[model samples]
Target: MQFTKLGAFISLFSLISASALTFTLGAQEKSCFYIFTEKPRTSVNFYFAVQSGGSFDVDYAIKNPKGVIIHSDEKQRQGDFMINADEVGEYEFCFANGMSTFAEKVVDFEIKFQDENDIYKAKMPVQPNSQPNTHVEGMQTTIDNIDSQLDNLLKALQYYKTRNNRNQATVRSTESRIYYFSIFEVLLMVGMAFLQITIVQIFFKGSRKQLV
Candidate 1:
């Protein structure tokens, strides 16, 4: 949650074929940026942020690495961007809220490569095969396995909940039907008894007067 300043934390570096750097803003309040690299197979990413301006609302790009108006939008807070590097080495990424505009902002950025852990391994440069010591295929395989397990777990939980809800609904319906049937039977029996009593009272009264 610490928004580190790009000026103090990171420095720019260059490499072959596109200088190994491209930056883009997000699809939100401030702006959005994207980098398309020509180098195949290998890919790298650097995350960065910056806080600038404190006045009326405005949107513009101070420096776009690609030099083609990469992104522009009105921002109320700070700006966030993600840059991609196709071959590794060093890449430069930046953001600005103009000199006199918007509210004060804070930014925090980090480099993400291979999976989250690969970045830590990248720090040891003087060592042999520090980052990709084993093989990129192996790292990708591990990531694939982890993703599969997560998907299966989510599916299993969803099915269990759906079945339980179905069972509860069936039980409720059956109980309601039985309750209504019992009430109807009791009312029918009472009606039959009342009719029989009326017929017997009229006939029996005539027989009693003749005997007297």
Candidate 2:
């Protein structure tokens, strides 16, 4: 349950993002990711957010190792879920963009595997000891607090990063629309000016003929 090296701790968490799926009329696109639990009753943390694309929403589903749906949602922009892995096998997490047309979706997701012992230790009350090792107990408590704070900080940073990316994508899309609209407006004005000049010239010729 204890990890001595940072690499070992990092290995328990998996961060995977699907490539952008370009949606077309009557086209259905789905991305499925899998993570395995080596032990039963492992705590799995699932976090996801739609970073960009149309409506900033996507459908998601999670299935157990037996291929039964455990959780699902439609047109969700973001979610954070914790699942208890009772079965020891690969679990499926999927994203579907079938309902969208002419717009692609970009999704950011993370799956974290945590031992049940750690979860329980954090939740369970500590029993009093008549002659407990004061120094060791104090050190352990401090370490646990630090670890919990770091985990929370990491989540916060990731949440902000996703928001920033989504906002930037929105700005770029708006800029593109504005650029094309300006061009269309300029062409419309030029066409109107040409039509007016032609009409004025025709009127002047008619007046000259009538006067002559």
Question: Which candidate has the top score in TM-score?
Answer: 2
Alpha-carbon local distance difference test for all models: 0.42, 0.72
Off by over 4 Å in 1: 1-140, 206-212
Please give, for residues 1-212, the per-residue lDDT of candidate 2 as tens digits. 21111122233333322112222211257766667766898778888887778888888898898999999999998888788989988787778888887677777676666663544344324568746667768877887898789889977987897789788988999999999999999999999999999999999999999999
* Model 2 TM-score, all chains together: 0.77
Per-residue C-alpha lDDT of model 1 across residues 40-94, encoded as one tens digit per residue: 3334434333322233223444223335443445543333344334332222333
Which number leads on lDDT?
2
- The whole-model C-alpha lDDT of candidate 2 against the native structure comes to 0.72
Indicate the residue-level lDDT of 71 in model 1. 40
| Location of the lowest summed lDDT over 10 successive residues in candidate 2 | 17-26
